[model samples]
Target: MWIVSALFAAVIAIFAQLTIPLPLIPITGQTFAIGLAVTILGLRYGSLSVLLYILLGAIGIPVFSGMSGGLGIITGPTGGYIIGFLPAALVMGIYLEKTRFTSSHAIIANIIGMCITLLFGAIWLKYFANLSWPAAFTSGIAPFLIVGVLKAIAAALAGVVVRQRLLSAKLLTTKTVSH
Candidate 1:
């Protein structure tokens, strides 16, 4: 499961490295995948999944966006976000467990995760881009909200759908056994 999560997350990370025209942060769906991973895998596995992704990248695997890798990726403008994934996963998992996969819980958890990751991402952007605080927000935190919300919604939908499917399958099995 851990390996699956890690490999899945790494693929998402690489996919997420795609750039959209945002002055603050580059657009990527990796956050969506991260949140999805947390919701699905829960805390320990989720956090490890993201952590392993960073480690993989740092080890020079071309698993990051733009096919980039190594420790330098973490030291670059987007490094904060890379570093932030673990804590973000942790936060997402905690909320998932406590909220039990309700929509409200998913939303709140997602927002918190987004904020934390953005905070780290912005700080790293500043260090690398040599931007002031305001500049960082203007450039790094401003343009990603729409996509983030979309991703969260997708995660919620996936959860609801998956949950129902599992329940339905279990019911069918139980019915068959009773006959």
Candidate 2:
């Protein structure tokens, strides 16, 4: 489980580099990686992977978006979204675990996760960047809405398919039954 979690953490790092620069926050593959990790690894291991990724970044490892790292990055204006990944992963993983690991459920869970990330990000950006709430929403959350939804759907579809293959190969284990 630790090894798998570590691998997922690495996946998050790699995905983080797939970024599209924005004014306040770049559109990166981190959210997609977060959804995929939780969808495939479930609650425990999935959350662990997110924690590991954050820890790596906090320790000055260049594992975050744009290959940047260190505590400053986490404490910066965009830190909220990065920090939000943990709870988002936890909630998403729990939803999938409690319900079903099907694509539909994963999609719903990932959307919820996306909102959680955006909420944290917008709130954090408001304070850290000294911006108004409306400004924060405009810069932090608005641009990501459509793109986030599309990423959530992609994560769900890809995650479920990959998870099914892993389960079939006995490379992974799950407590919840897939639909």
Candidate 3:
């Protein structure tokens, strides 16, 4: 069951990467998936699923943003953002599991995940792009904030919806069996 969930999330991530490409950094729904994935899969498998997606892209599977691939792609200006996904996914997964994925809890977890992604992205961009803190904030974060916030909201809603759906299904199944 866990494996199926992981595979489902991974497939969604790959499709999201291919379909959604931002200007320099692709605006992926994968981050949203990362939140929901972790909420559903928990920490260990959630992180592993993200790692699997990255590995597939790194090995020339064209799963990166805008169909970008290879090791060099990861080391580029956007590399930090790509690398950020690992910890972001892990943090979000663990946080969501701990909170039990209520709407409020999902909101908090989603924001934390986005912040972690931005933090790692900013620091890495500072080194790779050679930008100052202000510059990095201006370029690396400022542009993405609006869209990132939307993504976080969407992720949180998705998390709550999926959780409710699963719980309802489980309850229905239980009642049917009891009858």
TM-score for each of the candidates: 0.83, 0.96, 0.83
lDDT of 3 by residue, 77-133 (tens): 777877888898878777766656677777787888888888888888888888899
* Model 2 weakest 10-residue run by lDDT: 170-179
lDDT of each: 0.72, 0.92, 0.71
Tell me how far the alpha carbon of residue 57 in candidate 1 is from the true structure, in angstroms, after superposition: 0.7
TM-score: model 2 vs. ground truth? 0.96
Highest-TM-score candidate: 2
Ranking by lDDT: 2, 1, 3
Q: How would you encode candidate 2's per-residue C-alpha lDDT over 1-179 as one tens digit per residue?
A: 88889999999999999999987799999999999998888888889999999999999999999889999999998799999999999999889988998999999999999999999999999999899999999999999999999999999999999999999987876543233
Stretches off by above 4 angstroms in model 1 are: 21-24, 163-179
Cα shift from native, residue 148, model 3 (Å): 0.9
- State the displacement of the C-alpha of residue 35, model 1, in Å, after optimal TM-score superposition: 0.9
Report the Cα lDDT for residue 136, model 2: 91
